[model samples]
Target: MWLFLSALVLLAAARSLDWQAWLADKSRQHLCFGAAIALVPLWMLQAGIRDGLEVHFLGLTTLALMLGWRLSQLMALLSLLLVTWFGIEPWHEFGANLLLGGILPISASYFVFLLSYSYLYRHLFVYIFVAGFFNAALTMAVKTLAFAGYVTWSGQYPWQVVVDDYLSILPLLLFPEALLNGMAITLLVVFRPQWVRTFYDRDYLINK
Candidate 1:
């Protein structure tokens, strides 16, 4: 079921991507390739739990906010291939990594940003706080919960054992994830708004 769901989501995301449009623009092409390369190293630094499970920092929220979800998904898939090549992650479990570590965070951040876009005041602080900091934390929180479910379903360890050892410290990851994404987005929006695909000074900063 995990494989099936991951494949389905990847299919949908692949169909949504504008490859031609992205490739045609030189600047975007540089960013697309650069972000994908960056993700490889970022994903490789992991704290392993068992043979197949590991805890790692994810830059997915920052990538999604900067490049938009389509490019972020592509970068994630690219990074997955890179990590598997280096044996940081197993080939057989690529689908799991793609979904849980990649798509999950990107989707969470995108949804929160969409909500902020629709109903919240279009202030810089709102974008940074609600969409950037809080959503990044929430993404990690959800991923941690999903990891718990994954282990339980796979019978990797006793439920009590997984929770007692793993989930106990899972939320500890949230603040660091939030801080990295929050500071990164804050810097991009402040100094390089043009580079962040979703940030618009006119919409968020300039008064109409």
Candidate 2:
């Protein structure tokens, strides 16, 4: 299932990506390099807050905003593979990690982006709040629930303990997740808006 989803992501990227546009921009290589290279260390720097629950900052909302969902999904798959390759994560857990850790948060981030785009006014603040901070917090919440659900369902962790231990510290993660993604988006929107695919000057800045 993981391999199949990765393959589907490849296909989606091929169909959605502007191949010519990307090929024309040599600078995008640097951005890709920065994201891909930096994320390994960030992803690996995890804290085992509980027996089976590990906490890591998922900086994927920024990645999705920068690369767009298709490419971002592809990046997510690649990131997991790279982490597994380096032995940061065991090989057996790759599928579950890719689905729960990679696909879940990335997809949730994009979903938040879409909802904001559809319902809210195309303002800079709205984008930052909805697509950046809110998205990150919401994604983290969903991811936490998902991981908790999986552990409970698999009988790896008892429901009562998972609720008390694993779920206890969840609220503490939200603000930091929001800050990480919010600050990154704010910086990009302020300094290098062109790099963020979801940002547009005409939509976000024209009125201001």
Candidate 3:
């Protein structure tokens, strides 16, 4: 199952790559490298009861909001490779970890941004609150539940133990996730708005 899922994730990532676009813009290439470099340390600062089931401040929501999901995945892959190389994470579980902890949350974050962009009021605070804060909190919640379910289904841990040890920490996780990502987006919007790909002054700041 792990091998199969890993293969599928690799295939999806390959198909998702915008090679021409990435090659055309050198700055974005640097951005990807810089973001990945930052993420490696962030992911290292994780805590958990068991070996494979660690919880960390996932900066994936901000990554998705900044670079779009495609580049976010690429950046995550780069970070995960470094993590694995450093022996913090086993290479054998790389695909499963990336699929669950990286791509899933990143995609969820992007989906929330899309919903906000389409239906919500186009205000700066709305963008910061919904796409930045709310999205990070909600995505982490979903990822928490999904990870619990995956562990239980894989027979690595029973449901009760998973709930008690892993799921129980979720509430504590949400606020920090929200605050970190929210503050990040806020600072970027104020100082380096161009760094955030999903943010547009015309959309959020022009009319209001």
Candidate 4:
């Protein structure tokens, strides 16, 4: 499962990520590097009982909003590697950890962003509230549930313990997660709009 998932990530990156565009821009290079570096500390401060069921504030919703899903995946991979290198996460469980913590939230965030961009009103408040705040909360919920499901399915930890310890605190964490991501996105959209790739001035701010 590990090898297959790792390989699958590689394939997805190869196919989805625009290598030439990302490589040619020095700004993009620096931005991605900085984002990856920033994520390391957030990922380090985690709580877990089982081997691979660690809980951490994933900043991927903000990242996906900033860099778009394709670039966010690459950044998440870099951050995961850094976290593993710091000995916070076990190297043996790399793929499983990446899947649960990295891919799931980033993809979910981007999916929500697309939905808001496509179907909903293209107002700045909508982008900030729906795509940023609400999306962050939902992503947190999905990621928490995914972690609980993984531990239960793999038998790495007891289901009851997961429910009592991990799932129990999920509601408390959601607002903070939303606030964190929503605030970051709001600042970027207001001051450094170019930094957030998913946000467009014309689309969200032109008429209003």
Residue-level lDDT of model 3, residues 103-204, one tens digit each, is 788988999999999999999999999999999999899888878888898898989999889999999999999999999999989998999999998999
In model 4, which runs have C-alpha deviations exceeding 4 angstroms? Answer: 48-53
Largest TM-score belongs to which candidate? 4
Clashing pairs in 1: none
Candidate 1 stretches greater than 4 Å from native: none
TM-score for candidate 4, please give it: 0.95
lDDT of 2 at 91: 84
What's model 1's TM-score? Answer: 0.93
* Each model's lDDT: 0.83, 0.83, 0.88, 0.87
Q: Please write out the lDDT profile of model 2 over residues 89-199, one tens digit for every residue.
A: 878767768778877788889988999988999999999998899999999898889889988988888898888878888999899999999999999999989789889
By TM-score, the better pick of 1 and 4 is 4
Ten residues in sequence with the least summed lDDT for candidate 2: 1-10
Error of 1 at 74 (Å): 1.3
Per-residue accuracy of model 4 over 97-186 as CA lDDT, tens digit each: 788788888889999999999999999999999999999999999989987898888887889988987898898889999999999999
Which regions of candidate 3 are displaced past 4 Å? 2-17
